[model samples]
Target: MQIIKAVYINEMFKISKKKKICTSLIFLLLSVIVAAIVVYSLNNFAGVSVTGSSEFSVMVLTILSYSLFPLFTAFICIDMFAGEFADHTIKFTLTGPASRLNVFLGKILAIATFIASNLIVVAVLSFLFSLFLNGGISNPLRIIISYIMAFLPIFIFALTVVLISNFSRGTTSAFMFSIFVFLVFVGLSVAFPQIKSFLFTSSFDWYKLILGSYINVGKIFRIFLILLGYGLMLFAAGYYLFEKKDI
Candidate 1:
C-alpha cells in the first residue's frame, strides 16, 4: 500500500512538473469564451433569448462535453502514457519499488484525477460564465446531474487511449492510432446511426438524458452499463499489455 501510494505521489509530481496548468487554463478560458459568444450572438442577432434556458445550458454542456473535452483528454492521456514511454522515461519509474500493478494504478489515478478535475472546472466555469452573461441555468440540478454523467465517458476515453498507448511503439504512433480509432468510431456512428446507444462516443451527449422533460431511466442505465463495461475492458487490456511488456 505504501509503495502504491508513493508511486501515485511520484506520478503526480512528474505530471505537475510538466506544467499542464497553462493548457488547462487555456481550455477553461476557451470554453467560457466560446459559450459566452454563442449565447450572446443567439440572444442579440437571432432574436433568441436563450439566457437561463435549459436548452442553452444543454447546448453549452453538449459542445463542451461531446467535442472538446474528449479530444483534450486523449492528448493528455497520450502524453502521460505513450509520450513518456517513447521518450524512454517510464523505464526509470518501472525500476522503482512499486510493482507493475501499483505503477499502472498510480498512472491511472493521476490521469483520471487530472481529467476529472479539468472537467469539473469546465462545468463550473461554464455555469458561472453563463450566469454572468444573464444566461441563467434553468435547472442547476440538471447541470450537476449532466456533469456527473459526463465523467463516465471521459474515463472510458482515457482508458481506451491508455490501451492504445501501451500497445503502440511511439507517442506519434499512439496519437495517430488514437485519432484513427476516433475517426472510425465516428464513421461507424454515421453508418449505423440507429445503434449509437451501444457506441461509447454516442454517450458523449449522455447528459441530454437529464435535460429533457422526461428522464429515461432505462436509457440512462443502459448508457451507464455500456461505459462502465468499456472502461473495465480497456483497463484490463491496457494493464495486461503494460504488465507483460518489457520496459
Candidate 2:
C-alpha cells in the first residue's frame, strides 16, 4: 500500500511536469469560452435563451466526452506506457523497490486521478460561467451527479488505452491504434444499436440515466456491471502485458 502510494505520487509528479497537462487545461478553457460565445450569439441573435447553468454544463460535457476526454486519456496513457518504453525510461521505474503489480496499480490510479481532476475543473468552470450567464443553476445536484458518474466510463476508456499502450512500441503507434479502436467500436455501436449497451464506448453517456427525470436504479446497476466487466478485463490484460514486457 505504501509503495503504491509512493509510486502514485511520483507518477503524478511526472505527469505534472509534462506540457500536455497544461495544453489540456488551455484547451478546456478555450472550449468553455467558445461555448459561451455560441450561447451568447444564440440568445441575442437567434432569440433563444438556453443559457441555463445545468444546460450549459451538459453541452460542454457532451463536446468533451465525445472528443477531448478520450483523446486526452489516450495521450496520457501513451505517455505513461508507450512513450516511456520508447525513451528507455521505464527501466528506471521497473528497477524500483515496488513490485510490478504495485507500479501498475499506481500508474493506473494516477491516470484516473488526472481524469477526475479534469472533470472537476470542467464542471466547476462551466458552472461558474453558467452562473454568470444565467444567474443560477436549476439542478446543481443533477449536474454534480452527472459529472461524478461520468468518471467511470472515461476511466474504462483509459483502461482500454492502457491495454493498447502496453502492446505498442512507440507513442505514435499507440495513439493511432487507440484512436482506431475507439472509432471502430463507435462505428459498430452506431451500426448495431442493439449491442450498444454492451459496448464501453456507448456507455460514455451513461450519465443520462442519472440525469433523467426518473432514475432507473436497476438499469443503471446493469450498465455499471457491464462497464465494470470491461474495466476489469482491460486492466488484467494490460497488466499482464506490462508484467511481461522487457523493460
Task: Show the colliding residue pairs in model 1.
Answer: 52-135, 52-136
Candidate 2 similarity to native, TM-score: 0.97
lDDT of 1: 0.80
lDDT per residue as tens, model 1, 153-217: 87888899999999898888887898888778878998999987788987888888877889999
Per-residue lDDT, model 1, residue 17, is 78
lDDT of each: 0.80, 0.90
Residue 52 error for model 2, in Å? 8.1
Q: Model 1 TM-score? A: 0.92
Candidate 2 segments exceeding 4 Å error: 49-54
Candidate 2: the clashing residue pairs are none
